[model samples]
Target chain A: MRIRVATPSGHYRTPTYIQGKVGVIEAVHGAFRNPETLAYGGDGRPKQTLYLVRFDQTHIWAHAEPVPFCQNDRLLIDIYEHWLEPAPEE
Target chain B: MPGVHDRGGWPDVGPINKAEHELSFWEKRTDALLVLLSSADRRVIRVDELRRAIESLPPEAYETMGYYERWISAIETLLIEKNVLTKAEIDRKAEQIVEQRTIETTE
Candidate 1:
């Protein structure tokens, strides 16, 4: 799954580092109230699916200063379903 | 400016300090206060509200204050915003607490 890290003119939950980054959905943690709306005191009903998304350390820091990567290098982030979309087939 | 709490991937972010600290008594109390305030009985505030409140902080304060202070700041902000407590009341109570502590020290 590819998460959209687009510049939303306002507050957002998706971290910038993973924006436009491709990752694998490791697990789906079921529907959760949307923090985006809840943050503003709105009832975040119609819960959204939460997934444990995994990104390769190398993939996330690819553009940054070259750093070392290991075989087990992986970062797992909890992300809402709305933030994700089908990754373009490689 | 992006919310300072919105720290994700920035080229300049320092390495994550993994050191653990033995929490002080007040820190533990503050943590408990947050849980109590958010609990069902009180429901004085919600988790998301606290997050928004923390992010509502001045970027400098958000960046400079320790995590517990951030929680304290947010708790204070929400209490006042929700009309559960006035700023003056908090100030006076805090002063009173400090004064009592001073007296206790002298005794």
Candidate 2:
């Protein structure tokens, strides 16, 4: 899955740097209240499914430094459902 | 551009401060207030609202404030936004506190 690339105004949990990044679902963290809606005093109805996503450190930082990729290097984060979509066919 | 609160991958951010320190008196109070307000019994505020308020701060304030300072500032903003407290009321109370402190110092 790829994190949605967006810059909409308002409260969101997805960090900017991770937007548009591709990662694999490492684990499902169960449905949880949407923080974006909750931030504005709205009841987070229809909870979102959260997942632990893992991204290759080299792939994530590819646009910048060319630090050699090590299999041990991985970045993992919990992402909500709305912020993700199936990665485009490679 | 990302909001001021999102500084995860910034290039020039200074070294991470790993030093730990004892909590100040006011900082402990701020933490306790957060727990009390967000607890199930009170439900006065949510953690999400706190993060939103903190993220919404001006870039200057976001950069200048310490961790607990930011939390207290955000909590105050939420209180005002939720109509639990008025800005004027908070301001007057702050002034009263300052006056009391001044009198104590003079004495």
Candidate 3:
């Protein structure tokens, strides 16, 4: 399903590895962002755009050549919907 | 002007309330830095990208630039503690991914 990711403007801990990259919606974990931190002023409110995105494994490997066992590692992108798109068929 | 006791006597008026002025200056700087840091962490852009954005600001702002240094350091520390960006690398691993895409498309 097409989903939107949260993209808040600020200093965040999202790995540079996932920045600006698109991923498939492996599963939707619900919306959330760290609200207590200075980023959210401790408000604890989940950012509306935040979603757990699973990168297409084949695409991720093609780009990030993972070490054998590490291939299972998932990319949790804190993104806004504008950054995502439908995965091109293989 | 007049020496302390020469004119009327009190402590001479002093040079523009340096302490208060400095405090206000730093306070504003700190607030600005916080806004930028928050934006960067919210996934708007990478930290280095944010730094470049800050550098683009006017030179006068640099007078209080120490505030930026402190804020960046604090944010980096927090990110490290949370296992986000590491000291070893600043850019994301996205480049490698992009490269792979190029190879696949060509083949």
Alpha-carbon local distance difference test for all models: 0.85, 0.92, 0.48
The C-alpha stretches of model 3 lying farther than 4 A from their native spots are: A1-22, A26-48, A56-58, A61-69, B1-107
Which residue segments of model 1 deviate by more than 4 Å?
Answer: A8-11, B13-19, B99-107
Model 3 residue B35 lDDT score:
70
Best by lDDT: 2
lDDT of 1 by residue, B1-107 (tens): 34577776645767789999999988899889889998989878888888888888888888889989999889999889889999999999999999999999999
lDDT string for model 3 (B1-107, tens) is 22111222123355554553344665677556557655745643334444434433444553355654545555555555457678665445557778889999999
The candidate maximizing TM-score is: 2
| TM-score for each of the candidates | 0.85, 0.94, 0.30
lDDT tens readout by residue for model 1, A13-89: 88777778899999989999998887766789879999999999888887677666775799999999999999999
Candidate with best DockQ: 2
Candidate 2 clashes between residue pairs 3 or more apart in a chain or in different chains: none
Q: Order candidates by DockQ, high to low.
A: 2, 1, 3
Sorted on lDDT, highest at the top, how do the candidates line up? 2, 1, 3
Docking class of 2: high
> What is candidate 2's lDDT per residue for A1-90, written digit by digit as tens?
999999758888888889999999999999998999999999997799999999988778888766567866999999999999999998
When 1 and 3 are scored with TM-score, the better candidate is: 1
Model 2's i-RMS, to one decimal, reads: 0.9
